[model samples]
Target: MKDYYEGESAVFPLFLVTSSDGAAWSRAMAWLFPTLLLQALLIVSFLHLIWDWFQKQSFNKQMFVLVWMRTVLGGLAAISPSVGSLEGMVFMISEVTLSIHMYVLFEIFLQSIVQAGIFLWLAKRFLILQRK
Candidate 1:
């Protein structure tokens, strides 16, 4: 079986972003068709998930939490461009994915946290009413 990276690499622009220097960003952008396509799919999926959750559809909270956590960790891992000996290509791949993930994860987690807080507040009110 192909590695996940390999599966994505053939079509994704990760190679272009990571392997090129200053003169290559434009050319790399041209080669980034797969990456852009996947990003579109991601946006659709995220919209569906949010819509489904809001509609009271059954969904796992843990999945959102896990994605959120991974995003945060990945963002941190991409922070330092100067610290590692990794190839420029690999670093670029990490940095871009991390940045995208961080943004998506934060948005999802913000909604989740707000929902949880409201639920807790209601539960506390219910308990106080029962004690009267």
Candidate 2:
């Protein structure tokens, strides 16, 4: 069996599982499904928030809703994967796999935090303008 990281050099990072075996591919998909689902949900929620804003909803309300949704969904996505196994099935259980999962979780969490901060700042500015 060809190792997923076969023929890789120090100059390049292994970003994907290159193995051709069915088990490897299945394992990759199992790990990827939830992440993709959460991302799709986040995008849909964002679009809905934009629609609400265009509909003349209160800016503060919209900001709060967006931030809340992002926080909840982002946290769920971050903790959804087991890293070592899924439903008693082990897939690509290796250090590289673990590293990839950690990287993706961290990225999701960081993006959520940044977006929430930006939304809060915008809400504060809107309130100030409304007061004036």
Candidate 3:
């Protein structure tokens, strides 16, 4: 393989942003595409699994809430930028599909870490209400 430390290769979007010096950008591009593809695949696969689960299981409030949240998060992710540049103007470099995949993963991660307690409390309340 050719050395990735060479030139300012074009990003997929072609006009999002390019490094003037070609140092950090070059390294990032080397690993960026493949990683993005893998990430997309994983996200899509997980979404498909969730869909399948929905199809097989009987409908319930808890499942409904979980699936609804996932759907909304996935929708947000679908519009996410794989990488953005703030140099002068905002630009998105990643494809929509890849962007969404990555965003979903990130959103879920943040939700888990940042709102774990709140989510647990809400889930408990929801369960209690559902029992009545």
Candidate 4:
């Protein structure tokens, strides 16, 4: 009954908190903030494209297609399993949006090209008529 636990000893690992070397938590926050910001930007830009398209009342058919496609893609993204898997879906969304943006830009460009070509052709014809 005197001292059965007298010689018992216990050792626990000690965690040292140091300021000169930043903690793992701060480094993680630094990396995470930028990635989250980029994702946010992608979403914002896609939404802006949609708003602009609707505002213009142009490309009715293409706009409908884009609207439906984005709706489905966004739904899928919402239900996706986790961030890792959803990252690919986000890329897919970005690709689709960019493709639409490029198509819209190209339409404007090609229209200008066609208009210029027709104008020049008409000018050449006028010159021929004047020469005759």
Candidate 5:
């Protein structure tokens, strides 16, 4: 038989071996490592924030509310779309995750804001402000 890739006179190989997948794996690793690091850092940072809030006796409730909506709920939303096989849902979750991640990155700014409706500050020992 003739191979379509070559002229009709060319014969196809008895066994085909290709390096395309090797190239693809290399490309995948290029981004995969960095993505893993980023995801780990994001998880750590958000976990630290939640831990801080839990330990704190005083903070802006409104700030926490906004943060909760953006980080916690957004994280949940991101997770929800991923477990399903709906078309385009992963893309949508990715977009949402990207936006929420940005917000989470700037959470300290939210932390600095004044709570509008109600403020909670009932600490006695000491307050620790983590700076990134």
Candidate 6:
């Protein structure tokens, strides 16, 4: 077992055995497996939400437009810092804390926006199809 580090702080523990041959593969799998699993779960949940919304026959065009705007603006705001840094541009902006906590919050926010958009869009499309 070894501790992975970024800068001076120990980040996470890496469990390793005597065998070096399979170490790289194991490490890759450790990261990839959980990511793939979570993505699959999210997709399944989002689809379920869409189905539920359709079954309930709840579709609002006004709300869809509002959510679309929110999602687009929120996504742009989240990526602005990275984009500005990469472009060597600076604008008057309040300092935002960058930490694990902030990262998790941003991820949750983005995921909600995505799920909401998907749900509303599918519901609207299905409602239209039913009408025609």
Best by lDDT: 2
Q: Candidate 6's residue-wise lDDT over 51-123, tens digit each?
A: 5554554345434543443444434344454321311124312232234324534564566567666756775
Model 2 Cα lDDT, one tens digit per residue, 1-132:
133345543111243454544687688788797986787667666766676463365655655555555544544333343322231123333444555444544555566667756756765698699999
Off by over 4 Å in 6: 1-98
Taken over the whole model, the C-alpha lDDT of each candidate is 0.45, 0.53, 0.47, 0.43, 0.42, 0.47
TM-score of each: 0.28, 0.37, 0.28, 0.26, 0.30, 0.32
lDDT of 1 by residue, 29-121 (tens): 776898857754664465457654543522345334434433443233335431121222255455445444444445545654564445445
Instruction: Please give, for residues 1-132, the per-residue lDDT of candidate 5 as tens digits.
Output: 123113433221212222234775577668888996786567447656876655453445545654555444444344443312122234433423444434433553344343211223312122333331
Clashes of 4: 0
State residue 36's C-alpha deviation in candidate 3, in Å: 0.9
Question: How big is the positional error of residue 8 in model 3, measured in Å on the Cα after superposition?
Answer: 20
lDDT of 2 at 67: 55
**TM value for model 2:** 0.37
Cα lDDT over the full model 5: 0.42
lDDT per residue for candidate 4 within 1-132, as digits (tens), equals: 112112222111112122223675477567787986785567447646775554454444444444443343433344553121344335433323444334433454454445334534554587699999
Off by over 4 Å in 1: 1-96
The list of candidate 2 runs beyond 4 A from truth reads 1-68, 78-96
CA RMSD of each candidate after superposition: 14.3, 9.7, 13.4, 22.9, 16.6, 11.8
